[model samples]
Target: MALFIFRSIPMNTYELDCPAVPFETVGKTVAQVVSRIEQRLRKAELEPEWVVAANWIDDANDSLHGLKADALWPVVVEGESRLCLSVAIGRSEGWLVQIDHVRLHKAGDGGHWSSVALLRIKTLTRTHAWAVAAAMSRLLEID
Candidate 1:
């Protein structure tokens, strides 16, 4: 028999502070964040319970517009995978969602937005979810 080798890798876990993270209802709020999340995942080959939503708001004064901006909206997928989205809502009209940039480092110091393409929701691909998560992490200063 051939020799079989196995190696164990250590994993890093990130936790969220529910009391620290701030969120607000978008639009008329007929549909909650959970509902929107469900819709997004329904098209994927995954179960609803496998997904989790996390929100973040910018605490810095440099936030866009006069209103506080929603910095990061992370959707956990397939257990260890995640799709993080960042959006800013116009005080009067529809929300303007933009992809900031992606970060592969946990330090959250380097990475340029131009390295990643900013695609609209319609043009976004499921294959790019990991990159989106990295971008959101950089935007939120989370790495």
Candidate 2:
């Protein structure tokens, strides 16, 4: 008989294949870029609520000034009937904007949510922010 031994090896989550796409800044600073995006959303009559993530900023208000290029900023927009949009500010390599459709499930007394990515648009410049807002508007059919 031969003795068998097995060892558990930890995996590095950061090693995952996450390609970074190029992003061109429309404004001189990150704050300006975010402001423009908010303006676009308002023009479409969509109320945007910026949210804070566990590994991200502590306060939502901090997003405007402390946006890290290597970190992601999540923004939640209100208007769609059943769909929701989330925008991430940056990635390891460049800036990326992703839009997802969220579905809510009711369980007993509590509820859970699931999401499917509707679009993954790499922002090449500041104009891309407006593009993202427009895509969200069209998807939600706000007007």
Candidate 3:
């Protein structure tokens, strides 16, 4: 008989084969990219030059209302819903890479992150829920 055990964290984490794909490095590692995302949002800049989680910046107040730790960008490929990427600041210092995939679910009430395939996003900053959506277009077709 085999003893059964369950883990709290989901097991559908995604890992980017950055090396396997041929995108020139921006002179930074994936960790660096994530850090930049965090730093930019923390600043009091008027405009969000870099893309944010669906551009949650409040135009009138100039505030990031829906902005959470894991800023998400969703994408739809061939009618299939896919998360483009998610970025967040690290707790101690860097991004938590172990099991770093966002579990796809339906967006419940209160205007959660919704997708065409009825998926939702839960952005957790303190806990280890940071995730980045996969860019289907970029990953699928590489030069």
Candidate 4:
């Protein structure tokens, strides 16, 4: 005879906060900060299915340039289909992080889907990276 046992974990119980341990960001550039955010998200097991986008901006005068990074996750929330977290470092804007709700609509009988952004958090500092990762992780736990 063989004995078997199975364990079922509950869902939607993830904490949407940064880890209690301190995060070090001293002397780190914007790209490094973005890398940290990606690391945290992957450590929390939310990277496999997420979509990540990165854009680098530059001008001829070399006076305006920076990198923009965005991570998107598909969610099943009421009246919404997806969520995006974006971080950007612009020439004038030091560091900006935004969380937006993404809604998909059919494009005029063409069978194409268009996405619209519904802004959630307009601006957040680089230190909020861990929090953003946590939020994305929590979304995966939704049932």
Candidate 2 C-alpha lDDT tens digits along 1-143: 99999999653222122124222332334344344444544554333344122223333443232333233332334532243444456554334554444555668888777654333334444444444545444533422
Global Cα lDDT for candidate 2: 0.41
- All candidates: TM-score: 0.20, 0.35, 0.19, 0.32
Error of 3 at 76 (Å): 7.7
Kindly report which residue stretches of model 3 are placed more than 4 angstroms away from their true locations once superposed: 1-77, 96-137, 140-143
Cα lDDT tens digits, model 4, 17-132, are 54444345344443454455556656754342223323333222211222233322234355535545565553453344444434555566554433433222222344443444
Q: What are the root-mean-square deviations of the candidates from the true structure over C-alphas?
A: 17.1, 18.3, 19.0, 13.9
Best TM-score among the predictions, by candidate number = 2
The CA lDDT at 69 in model 1 is: 29
TM-score of 4: 0.32
Whole-model lDDT, model 1:
0.32
Q: Tell me how far candidate 2 lies from the true structure as C-alpha RMSD in angstroms.
A: 18.3
Cα displacement (Å) at residue 70, model 2 = 32
Candidate 2 regions with alpha-carbon error over 4 angstroms:
1-81, 92-94, 139-143
The deviation in Å at residue 92 for candidate 2 is: 4.2
- The weakest ten consecutive residues by lDDT in model 2 span 14-23
